[model samples]
Target: MAGFANLSQAARTWSIGFMEFDPQNAFNNAGAVLRQLSALLVSYSLSFVGAVLLLVIGYLVAGLVERWLNAALAHIHGFDLTLRNFFSKIARYAILVLVFIMVLGQFGVQTASIIAAIGAVGLAIGLALQGTLQNIAAGVMLLVLRPFRIGEDVQVGSIRGTINEIGLFATSLHTSDGLYILAPNSSLWSQPVTNYTRNQTRSNAITVRIKPDADIDQAQRALIRLAQSDSRVLADKTPSASVSEVADDAVTLTLTYWTAVGDFGGTKNDLTKRAKLTLDQQGLSKV
Candidate 1:
């Protein structure tokens, strides 16, 4: 009977301690905090995944559109493939910028005000670069006109070089000294441009002075032979070598011939060197 009474008292004391501890209330608050944390983690994960997917979709869309337009415009009656590649790149980049803006917007950013501020800043920057902007405008005109293109040798603004690239605001030229010279299109547009590659073949004229005492007839024959022997020289254009000037010490003979544009510089050098050698071999003298 005493053992049963002690067990009943112990049970009553344990029940009182449980009420004071409040285990159910504690678990309820803990479970709510866990749910909030889990929701936040899921939201952050979704946002990150969404950003990545947006960027990938943007790139693929831009690429496909760029490729399609490039091909279509290249085959258009009045357009050039170079122009197609150029404009397509610009469009693609523009699209990418827009996509980037959208991604930023997804992160709860106020893009409109940001874009407005950017526009204002861009306007200030543009004002600062007025001259460069003019060059860019002129470059657009040059590309449209297509006065010259890559690999074409041209003379503009007292500078001569092979055109390596035609960018938005500047033109790159590889000079004879192996230097790349970027000439602004505003200056290029204002100046006269001479494109040597406009025609398939070009005329090369060589002027050599010989002693006045030398026979003009015999010297003419020698120079003509020198001009004619080269395989690259064309005959249909009517090659000629004649006494063009009678100076105090020498008679200048100008030999004019036609050769492929590819051989412009090489042929000129080879012809000059070989002609001098041939004249010396024949005992011809300007001395």
Candidate 2:
């Protein structure tokens, strides 16, 4: 019986000892975990703050660099505004991308892995956007080669318009009839482009028909006088009149003249109207 009583008491004492030891051990472990968590939080907080500061500084620098690059490019002769802006924006975005990579590094990201992943994504995107990429490439070539400038009249394939804007993927144009057109850069670049106003002077002709009985020499003289009266006509080219066709019903006289490109339209229109009136006054035509 004494042995049994001692065993019961010892069992109780062991249970109490375990209860007390477990609580103290648990509390120590919890304290240690909290301390580690707090340290990590403080360190991460500092890194995050630093990263934000770096990003802000990077953005400011990017803006300044873009502006500086634009200004520098402006001095080069034949360097277009579109190209300058495009290159400047490229520089700015490159800086931002680098800053983004650096920011990720602060958070323990592997830059090499990131770059590889980005390259993979870029390749996939390039494959998916083949047509868009082609347009962009064509736009770059157009901007570099300068086939036409803004406000210049150009004809591409069946499209005829004045260049409004040249973008990274498309070119905007205003048609002669006041219609707006957005054409892919690839379309413009791939086709033969005819720039009407690129040259200083352009030759234009006006043909007038006179009655069959009308004196051919008199009609020619009248047409030449009409061309010469216009100040827009280039005196250096020396206006000439030729007999285009001699038919039983009527005789056709062709007046060829050179004028400044800017005034070509007005000069042609004026000469055409004056030629018709002058022929009528000279009794050269019935209608």
Using lDDT as the measure, the top candidate is 2
lDDT of each: 0.86, 0.93
lDDT of 2: 0.93
Evaluate model 1: give its lDDT.
0.86
Clashes of 2: 0
The regions of model 2 sitting more than 4 angstroms off are 1-61, 99-110, 211-214
Ten-residue stretch with the least lDDT total in model 1: 74-83
**Deviation of model 2 at 61, angstroms:** 4.6
**Per-candidate RMSD vs. true structure?**
10.2, 5.7
